[model samples]
Target: MSGRQLYFKCECLQKGGAFKFRGACNAVFSLNDEDASKGVVTHSSGNHAAALALAAKLRGIPSYIVIPKNAPTCKIENVKRYGGQIVWSEASVQSREEVANKVWQETGAIFIHPYNDGRILSGQGTISLEILEQVPHIDTLVVPISGGGLISGIALAAKSINPAIRIFAAEPKGANDAALSKAAGRIIRLPETDTIADGLRAFLGDFTWPVVRDLVEDIITVEDSEIIKATKLCFEILKVVVEPSGAIGLAAVLSDTFQKNPSWKECNHIGIVISGGNVDLAVLWDSLKKGK
Candidate 1:
């Protein structure tokens, strides 16, 4: 355990069991009546798909979800339960965008970029406001980075409120595009990603990259093994069900990269964003069986 006062901002217990619902709802409800009539469309691996589907359902509009063939079963089921029209795609960003484009063209639906839109970023930023209010004295936040929406939004809002507050991005080493981008001082896209934390596979988008570059304190990369260990700790010790991506913030906090950092010595009151809880039981059982 980290020798710090770790305050958990549990977005895992959100409406769609992930912080994604905040952005999806904002994007869906922000649409005008005419645009809403055409419905909404997007591509996602899992959490965002379910979030958008549920948001559209609440707004009485259809949601077209282009999902990769290899998305977690539990997430796919969530989309189905929320009445989304599923469009299957190959497990690649290009394939997902192509399929989503086709749907958008055919249906004339408003396209919602999962983590790249300003509306979505503002919605996710609400987390920072809530966190600061809930833990007034906290000076740092450890957030999991995927497409960069969550952390970008957080860094923007948190820094606006408390300029001295630190915002660290938590990333899986396998999908370390953001880390690479931060280091190279430019956006870096990975041709392929290989990470057990499916939700963290995405790279930063144009809108998110600028905020991350300027406001984020640093990137803490953790191994998949470390993520699994954090997931196990959440289940056994914290009694919280967290997906691997959601637990990556905790993983990063416990990682040697963070522990060994002399600059972070004064960051004693830390806040960790538990981003989601939509775990695949099969994956969970398998990891437990392997005792990782």
Candidate 2:
């Protein structure tokens, strides 16, 4: 770890405290004046909700956010602070979708999917653009996979700029849909997510499947404990406060997953995308103290 450097494209520090802002802003601004006047709606538990809310505010349009009732307090506050109109739903994925669709139908608000839109992908790809500009040469780009939006965008962008640069994904073992989907050659949805990384609970979307399947070099999964440990490591070593989901890429790196890879022999410089930083500090501390 002495001579080796792990450079990070810190989206955690971005507006609304996550990379979701880029996509949200793109989606919001993509609408024409006529359609934009009706505003937009989205189903999200945390970061995306806050992002879309803020984006709509900047565009001077309304934002309807469908959130799970059990979503984190901090994230809920962020959405409210951004002036998002809240629509409560059950924790089930179906409920979230149903509510968002209902709002869009009733209000004629444009439905801006969190990760399935083309414009969203283009906006998220800007992260790779910035990375390339900031760090010209790197062996690989490691991104955390949720619904595959971030990874798919980064893969497409990075591969276009540097075909030799490898793009890898870090996913949670408990919610291993991305890995399973990549292997089965299709998007796979888990019955339920079982990880502390709340932001990554969603399965891959239609738009991101092909991009991730074709461009990503590999997908590595880590346990919840590994993510928590990696989160602490980021704070201790890198002096960065990263949430569990945000630190999964580092978790994969610190684990044997990377070292065991065939590409490890040739890869020296690595670039990681720190996806978000909206974690609840009390929960993290309690979990760490209890060793769970």
Candidate 3:
């Protein structure tokens, strides 16, 4: 009765068009009625901001989102459509954080950190919890690492439920700060990051680093090209439209990064967290045509 025979947990169908909703909902629901009514603020390039916006809306609370000026227009629109108040900042990551902080100071809004808060982590952890229940026995779990909140939560939940379940964090090679930090045994900040996977662009947050370092088994890097290919493959094979960052986990597995392990062949029960499906249609079409 090995875990490999169990079914896979397809979280791509989660609310808000990504698995992020789990954590967002969890964090928002955990807030006391008073704090929740005070409203919330967060900074995100895309998916997380939308998740928070939707979650806050569900809670009958207002949300302020700080997004980089150059963030995908689709993501910005999603945030606004979900009832979030958007504050635009310089396209750079630093400015987004600064703007979010400024909003917090001015509004005195409760800051619902995108990845660093314990409540957020616990919320993200629920993805793994559901996966385990759905699949029953999962041998390997693949997750994309951005600010490390998602992977950190999944790793903790998966490991606690079954320590034998190996957890790997997939990241874009261009944005490999998490991998470098893991190797260095400390948090490493990238001076500059240039990756089409906007969701994975940020450096790991302080709260997320420790959980990832201690709980995660390994961090693997994938090229941007591979991510593109994987994204297209998901559209073709799974009939799911995944953003570049969301497809990293599947890209790593399909690219043979973990194929060398004999255990993988014997126990083919690999659970990939297909995190989001928020790609811009125009960008997707252009990338496909260019790749072809």
Candidate 4:
């Protein structure tokens, strides 16, 4: 939105329609044949569930997904299409974990956490690995954070290659636990949240919190309206259909956060990660009407 130059690292175009595929693939493949034979299990609202299901299918292994009842219909279809056995639960974090734990216990399946696993971090890290190669002189990266996998991986990889790049996180204000945690200098969890960024509603995981706290320079939270506005812009201007969670990075730029920061002036070349492209067309049309 500013006069400064910005480049987009479009992970929305990645497989399974999100960068979660990278982590899911890595986590699934890291398992041995005997382990994979027992199958794999996970709890997710959408993207990660679909990714892990697809990953398991590719490895010729079984997948059992514990999906929240509120998860998107398209995403549920994706998991089922990938041959994952679906188990439903309430939308709470407690409900998701309990259902997954039961499935894991019954099947003795390997549990691949959406963001808490190290192998998943390694897989997601590959995104920045490519960004640096393509844009060697990039001075800053703007990424969306939910459970923090994408930002954690990108921050770690990008800094390792060129310690010069500054990493920033874009989060929704309605579910701004990450931003709150950053400001508090410790981890924080919300018992509840309300936001259109469904993929980003989860509280930050323990493993991801440390990496995000240490490596991330700052986090900027935008209102739900701001998120919708950015989502509209992505579709109308960029000709790319981005979900609410995916558009938060561009929303951060349009918000006062980027402009108010003195550090932003130092960043001549910035990279923005388009985290996913799984917006429901029904919701997209509704958001478009609101944006107008």
Candidate 5:
């Protein structure tokens, strides 16, 4: 546990069981009446697919979701339940994007990039507004980083409100492109990723990279084992069923890098974003049974 006072912004409790709902909702609703009628399309591993589907349903429009064939069964069900037309693709980004593009072209659905749109970024930023309002004097925020929408929006809004507030990205060591990008002063994509935090495997995008580069203070990378431990802790201690990606912020805060750094001492009150709670129950039960 961290010595500093900790605050959790539980976006996992949101409509679609993830902070992804905020961005998806904003994007879907921002469309003009004509565009909305034509439907919306996007590619996602899980959460965003479900979020966009639910948002489109609320707006009385169709949602075409391009999902990797390997996505969790529970998440695929979420999309179906929310009335999305599912299109399957290979797990790779190129395959996902290619399928999404083909769907958009065929259906004339407005293409919604998972984390690279202005509307989505603005919507994700709302989390920071609520966090600052609730924790007026909080000094630092630890956010999970995937394609960078959540942290980019949070850093932009939080820094604008209190220019000195620190923003750190909690990234999976297996998918540490954000960390590499920060070090290299540009986006960096890995050849392949291997992490249990399935939702955090994405690299930064053009729309999000600028905000991350300018406003984020640091990146704290944690191993998959650490993420798993933090996920279990969320269920046992926090009484929250957080997915591995959602628990990465807590993992980062409790990691040696954050704990031993003297510079981090100034962050007396740290806020952690619990970004989602869409774990596969079968995997969870199996892990618990195996004492993982």
Candidate 6:
């Protein structure tokens, strides 16, 4: 974990504009013929819904997505563009889940959970598999944690590949349940969420908690300003339009939060997972020039 080379994985370049595709595709593929034919339903702030919609489209199955009323308009449009039906709920993750469950009860649609299913984890694991293949010896990996699906999947795969690799989860201070949960040694729910990183606001699932608890090395929380700064940096330095949640790993690195630990800097290479790229260009441009 210390004095090892680190490399970064830019999964923002992943298909469907985010790393969610890997999990969505895997979950859909894991379904039996009857299940797939019956279609799938899930709730999401944005990225996961789009990924699942696209995945269902690819599989020739229908997808029903429950989205919050205040979800980014662009994401809602993407879901429709990808041939998914949208069920709108109050502007909250809890409302979205309730709506999704209602849809499931009525339609018998297989619930393709946004971040809580074992098959989703297996699919998300493929991201680590790809990263390992791309970089031979990654000593430390920093991944954004939202409900712990992506990080849990990545940790499981990365640890299996090299037990010595250190896996860290980067979270926004506004949605710091994972950080708190890790400290409490149990799943802890957020009383209220107010982060710009909409995709990272959900609480960790029961299935995901166990995987993350046993496998992840640590959770690092960053401020909203830092997330904005990192998002701008990615656009300016890396020429990528990364969402706030997606840029958190970069934020952890750029803000020197990780570097605070002497041992962390000792690692020559650090791998950060740029999880998504579904930002509204106009909004991102405004954010980029805000303090300039």
Q: On residues 223-273, what C-alpha lDDT tens digit does candidate 5 reach at each position?
A: 887888888899999998888899999999999999999999899999999
Candidate 3 deviant stretches above 4 angstroms: 1-8, 261-267
Off by over 4 Å in 5: 288-292
Clash count per candidate: 0, 0, 1, 0, 0, 4
The residue-by-residue lDDT of candidate 1 on 141-247, one tens digit each, is: 99999999999888888999999999999999999999999999999999888888999999899999999999998999999899999999998988888998999
Point out where model 6 deviates above 4 Å: 1-6
Choose the strongest candidate by TM-score.
1
Flag clash pairs in model 6: 5-269, 6-269, 6-270, 7-271
- Model 2 Cα RMSD, Å? 1.2
| Model 6 lDDT tens row, 234-261 | 7787887788888888887765667777
Candidate 3: what lDDT? 0.83
Model 3 poorest 10 in a row by lDDT: 1-10
lDDT of each: 0.94, 0.89, 0.83, 0.89, 0.93, 0.85
Model 6 steric clash total: 4
Model 4: how far is 168 from its true place, Å? 0.4
4 or 6, greater by lDDT: 4
True-vs-predicted CA distance for residue 274, candidate 3, Å: 0.3
By lDDT, rank the candidates, best first: 1, 5, 4, 2, 6, 3
The Cα error of candidate 2 at residue 158, in Å, is 0.9
* Model 2: per-residue Cα lDDT over 2-97, one tens digit each: 134678887889999999999999889889999999999999979999999999999999999999999989899999999999999999899999
Q: List the residue pairs that clash in candidate 3.
A: 3-137
- TM-score (C-alpha) between model 6 and the true structure: 0.94
Native-vs-model 4 lDDT?
Answer: 0.89
Best candidate (score: lDDT): 1
Task: Work out the TM-score per prediction.
Answer: 0.98, 0.97, 0.93, 0.97, 0.98, 0.94
The sequence of per-residue lDDT tens digits that candidate 4 reaches over residues 1-292 is 6667778877789888888999999999999889999999999989999999999999999999999998888889888888899999999999999999999999999999999889999899999989889988889899999999889989889999998789999999889999999999888999889888999988888899999999999999999989898888888888887888999898998788788787677877888899888778897678668763
What TM-score would candidate 2 get against the native?
A: 0.97
Task: Show the lowest summed lDDT stretch of 10 residues, model 2.
Answer: 1-10
